[model samples]
Target: MSIPTQPTDPAATIPAVGRINWRAARAMLISEGRLLARNPGVVLWTVVLPVAAAIILGSIPAVRRPSAGLGGLSFFQLYQPILVFFAITLLAMQALPDVLTRYREMGVLKRLRTTPVSPTLLLFAQLTLILSVAIVCMALMVVIPPLGGAPWPRNPGGFVITYLLGAWAMLGLGMVIASLFHNAKVAAGFGSFLFFVMQFFAGLWWQRPNMPVWLRDISDYTPSGAAVQGLTDSSIGHWPRALHLIVLAVWGAATSRLAIRFFSWE
Candidate 1:
């Protein structure tokens, strides 16, 4: 009788190594950054509106005043986090999957097998560059608003923590999309759909404070929702709820695992 065998692991081809090639990694980063700068259209459009909106809103005295409708939270306070998450969500859901699928189709990933550099380095570089753009945008939104007289985030540490976790979860979702889809069109469509869903939960359509109690409860479990709420709390001088942080961590971990398990070079 023939012996049965287990299927090969997705990451088995890339053997474990004790060390990373930092020089190669640095070169990849520079190359990727140059490409990103060359194609600035997407980044420009995706981030400009939210950043401008945040600054405009913050500068206005009307939006800065607490409103009864938002449970005494000023409009700027409510929307700042939403805007921050919006930019990153767009990058993660659209830019990330789009680039990965294109690379796979062009055989860049497959060709890397013949090169000294690991294909994984390219993936890491893309993630770092994209996340770095999102972070820069985040910093601008936060710093500029206060200069315009809007309130600053009271718990800076909590704000930073929530943002990092949220970005991790969103980026992992992007990697998962790339790992699953072979066609660029298919990946873009799926990413676009996910982008809208994330925005809805992040309060792009409806402010989190204004959502119905039962509906808000439902949003709490989603990465976008949890992250937004946590950011809101941090902005208002409260530490993020344990539950929200836990939800973000779970989303990050689960999506990252799935991406690694299913990801392919081509």
Candidate 2:
């Protein structure tokens, strides 16, 4: 009878969805960066390999000779873009996926989910670290070549645009690999296989101009190939073909969506 009614707390009616914990994200990013710096394998792949390849190749007299097929640019000059793409590919296909897979396998991601920080923040942090490394590697690739007498890209803006697009495409591919594989070893093995295949198609081992017509046509649609072509075109003062940009954009968008839809956080 006329028992009682309790006052409700207005705050209780609302979900406690807080803003992103930037402090936590920043700390994780710093920790990840330090860990990455200590990993020699990552250093070799993302830094040493690309820079070494560029320097060693640039030193070759034959590579310094201008070729008609390359629009009067030497193989060394054309290879600058290839080296930049190589750095992106290494980070995306090998380092990033392996690290993410390891985190999931070791339950790091699971622990992260229980914290104030979202586990996705860790993923973003890893990507940011890897991208920072990629940028530094690419910068070295660009700056070192001129010391070897190679010309800089003719259209700096186009070159930068193409580089960014290519990096995004490759990183998206890496995210897909990270999402699909629960085992770090399996991810590393598959990532390595894909890395080598992409390198081949990107003209790391064989000149694109020397590839068979059909093979070249197919390679043009691949992320690495499109990236190389885009960079090379911009290096020579021409905007990349629409096909190159379209291929990179499609790869980036499709792979990123798939990764987001299916990503596992332990």
Candidate 3:
């Protein structure tokens, strides 16, 4: 007796076979942009808070203790980058979790599942939104502060380098948070908690190098710490800027890999 073989359908046989529809992706992006623009709370947290924090925090006589030739720089100049950092951090963490939860609840992801939308592409879309916000926030951070007489960056190249690296590092961190938590509440809570904790180590409250030995050691390894170092190095050249770059890149890569592996559409 001879054994029989079954034929396969080329499309059905490939489990992960689908190219993204750019039109669909573009539609998704437009929808996301509209949603972001319409949400008052999102606007408050993403835009208003950072500006308030920078000015409010910088205004505090205590917080204005200057270093790194900061005496020569105006108060707004010292705090401008910090404001952009806070805004980027805030937006990146909130974007994915809120969007994913709403999508899952609304059947957006489910409907998309039937199409050629890859998980990676969806992730990329979220990143693009965050990047847009970060860029805008950064522009505001750079431009608006100057209106208040903030000092211009002495080294524009260094400033650009720091902001780009730091933003991506936070973006990756946000993705990891979104992947780990299933519901919007859990994701939001975790993201918020981690944001505060990271901000502490990111030199928001105090310089990382001045922290206790154990804390300093931990800060050296965390994404926010690396980001703080990178941003600070843009003005004050203590460590080789390359080391901070490497740290941010490593965090971005590791967290992103973990996020992709554990991410769930549901």
Candidate 4:
């Protein structure tokens, strides 16, 4: 007589990312890019207006002149950072959450669990695509202004750092929106609400420098307020305030934690 060995389930052996699988991640990223290219309705709308606004503002000599009402900064200078952030806010709040919620609704994330490709890989792919789009949009806003004689940011390094941190924070918040709302329509409505709030703090309708001291102090702690101010400081040849950097970092960390905690593949 021979002893019999129990059969192992092959499905159980496929791990959910013990280590980062770069190859699978890349393939998924490519796949995501294709899907985005096929249906790019919201992203284009979110990105184009801000880029055009930046370029147009930079081109206008009047807007570049120092304005006493704007606290001695040119209108373009004050608005540039706000406009830059606007594109990012829309992409993160509206575009990112919409896609993610839809993926969950369609059972994409749940199906990926059985494959060698983990859902984490899919998330990395989505994030990469969204970030790439944001960066390209940012670059257009930054580069195209000079052709019309707008000045580049005085502290390029500082500006880039702050912008990147700000993007991370916003994207993380977007992830949280996806995690909370399974219904795509509900997620979209919430995202729109968030977008408007961010713009309000970014000085879309009211300039930060013009806000009352108490209100401005409150705004300083929010991601949009801190990021816009940081970008403004860098553009004016000053380093970003440590307070703003800390605020942005904290928001990024907290939002990412919440998203990961609550997000469900099913």
Number of the predicted model whose TM-score against the real structure is largest: 4
TM-score of each prediction? 0.92, 0.90, 0.80, 0.94
How large an RMSD does model 2 have? 5.5
* TM-score of candidate 3 to 2 decimals: 0.80
- Worst ten in a row by lDDT for model 4: 10-19
Candidate 2, 112-170: lDDT as tens digits: 88976789988999989888888888888777777777667888888888998999999
Worst 10 residues of 2 by lDDT: 6-15
Per-residue lDDT, model 1, residue 221, is: 94
| Clashing pairs in model 1, backbone N/Cα/C closer than 3 A | none
Q: What is the lDDT ranking, best to worst?
A: 1, 4, 2, 3
Model 2 residue runs over 4 Å out of place are: 1-18, 59-62, 69-72
Question: What TM-score, to 2 decimals, does candidate 4 have?
Answer: 0.94
What lDDT tens digits, residue by residue, belong to model 3 across residues 119-142? 456667768977877787777656
Order of all candidates by TM-score, from best down to worst?
4, 1, 2, 3
Pick the winner on TM-score between candidates 1 and 2. 1
Error of 2 at 110 (Å): 0.6
